[model samples]
Target: MYPLIYGGDARILEEVLEGTHPGLSSLKCRFCQINSLNPNLVKGKIVLCIGHRGGSEAAWSAFLAGAVGTVIVDGLQLPRDFSRIYPCLHLALVQAMVKELPTTSAQQGTGDNRIAEYNIESGTSMACPHATGAAAYIKSFHPTWSPAAIKSALMTTATPMSARRIRKPNLHMVQAISILVQNLRLVTGDHSVCSKAMNGTVWDLNYPSFALSIPYKESIARTFKRSVTNVGLPVSTYKATVIGAPKGLKINVKPNILSFTSIGQKLSFVLKVEGRIVKDMVSASLVWDDGLYK
Candidate 1:
């Protein structure tokens, strides 16, 4: 119902309906009248229902009756909203490939079937495994590193997403894994590479994403300290830059230039945010760019 929560599993319901009679006409029932329905007819077939009363309750009722799944043809229309519940592939070819996957055992019938070609679907479900795989790969090289360290590595290295310069950045795993591997040797060799003293808060843990909340009524200054372990060439320099800062907001990066003397050398910097009264939310980014890397 309502797009079936995007990735609702049809096989789960099919498994529940296994060995039960199929091809029975789907029954329509009120949300509260599901228990009164005849189980024999409801079992092993799709259930069609109206989602106006409650989508979740109706779906649960169908599940209890051993229905394969529920499809809501009509419901209360709601406002448009974006959800990160999962990722979606906008490509038509990918969507078509997914639809061709064998959903029933009958589709896979025959002995000694050696399949040479395959197609796949993409979503948060798909992305999650890739992220986990990246983490596992990093773990292979840094067997002694803790989970938090690996997570920090991934988060800190991910590419930032900017929408119309709105300053909202999402996770980019490819870039994250690249940076993780690039700095793996330095991180593994230095016990102090994952020090908590470097981060001012959980949000500032060299994370790939961050948010800053400033009270509107009072003028306040917030300082965040961050440190980076040099894994590149010895004696490298990086410059700090802030983008899309709001009016009346002053940002200062103490020692804006970071100079590293050797591999495994750690450098610290202070980010001070001073803002006056403001009515609207402000978004910005603090970036440290070496000539070759960001």
Candidate 2:
């Protein structure tokens, strides 16, 4: 949309531009936003916005500019607080449109008639709602649960996923996010995970996901601390196993067998994750199973 507008402007100037190139369209999509788009060019066209910022109001911005529609393209998860921030931006835009002061140089708007009635959203739109809703839903069930506990519960119970396909592109999709907050039980509160001291590696937290920040070209000798609670059978022993460890990596879990005498019993363990520094991405998993749960 913006590209066509730029080409038309260049042609009108009697300029013969050589080759195809993007001129500030990407920047506008990232930083400049609505102010970057001119009403003269985008009035009746669909605007293509590429990135998702924490404070971005891309959808509302396009609608206010009289764009007939908008398309949002993103590569990552949407910022969690986006839904809360959206209504404020929407109201502010309404106020601005109403108080179209002659003194303000900013193009007030095209008009009420040109406002877009529809929008198409992908990546960002599909992800944020689920996260926000999950947190809200969990809080509804356990109002006393701290934010950190809710966060840990969600992370711990999360299903492992990747965009990898079973067949070709769009043929077989990876399983979607399934957060079973109902099955999650918090042992206790530990705000250290949210504090600045636990800024880098969160391996010590009470969650299934493990992470270790190893600097490049440095020796790969790091230990992770983790805790687990028994939510299944009261009297059972679970064995720890590491899968998909890269070659040359040695992972040893201290006291790998966890025995629970009763439900809600919590146990802690240490993982001595040692490996040689490699250029490729390190992908692995630690599974705890008692021939029942994995």
Candidate 3:
């Protein structure tokens, strides 16, 4: 909806609506939001650009948002035309984004990129959100949780990326995110897996696999909300549930029964997740079973 208001070329808008791109709209919205905001707010500010290779809209959004410049990197090899599109001589750096340390930047034609532009870009876009979500959980479960405490929880609970789909990992499909968050439990929080209390999916071990990240290491629990879309068959009905809910932790789904017609349909319902982090990790298998429509 907002995209229409931004008013790009008619041809670009047409391609966007076709839905051939994965995070194009996400990229578009991010760019729009940041661009709409004050440039001063983002100048010298850091932004996380994920999965789009270097050509990702993430970098564009950051640049327009007033970023001193972007640390353009990718999970894979950096692209050739990247420097051509985003010249480095203009800003601090023009390089691949990495989450790793000893952050470095490579320049083009003339080695004019600055040394002050040292920052890691090792896929922090993916890393930052999980941290943010974990902090949210700590705040929810322990209302008294301080910003510092929440930060501690997130950093302490951090885990490494397990594996990728072998096929094109760069593609951002709802199915890929679902499998990543739900199946691998790569992302922590209630939104990780919608449960019955949430009035959503009914737990089914065999159908949808469960993966979870426990909010606490030594002790304590937390709550969180996750977004889920119908990526499987576009049947008329859909539900959600947590496979093995931990102690003190509870899951609930809002607007449980999902009914829709046609393709590309989306429903955003909150998953009320609250509880203690009895362990370092909690896993739940969410099952989207058939209903009347099926």
Winner by lDDT? 1
Per-model TM-score, in order, reads 0.48, 0.52, 0.25
lDDT of 2: 0.54
Q: Across residues 1-294, which tens digit of lDDT does each residue of candidate 3 receive?
A: 111112121113434435654344433433332232234444555443333433333455555545544433445564422222333322223233333223333332133234324333323465566557767877888786545445544543344233341223444546643564454454343355444353443322111123344435444333234444343366567765445556766767676667656444666555555656655445543444555321
Error of 2 at 72 (Å): 7.1
Best candidate per TM-score, number?
2
What digit string (tens of lDDT, one per residue) describes model 1 on residues 34-60? 443345666665555554443444544
Q: After aligning candidate 3 to the native by TM-score, how far in Å is the CA of 31 from where it should be?
A: 50
Cα displacement (Å) at residue 240, model 3: 1.6
Error of 2 at 252 (Å): 2.1
lDDT for position 149 in model 1: 70
Tens-digit lDDT track for model 2 on 1-294? 333223122121112111233353434543215444555555666555554442235545655655555545455453322222211222221111222234432322344232222222234344467688899998998787677667867875687654242111332223322323333334243222322333555555555567666777466777878777676799999998988777778889888999999987989899887768575446677788899876
The TM-score, computed over Cα atoms with residue i paired to residue i, of candidate 1 is 0.48
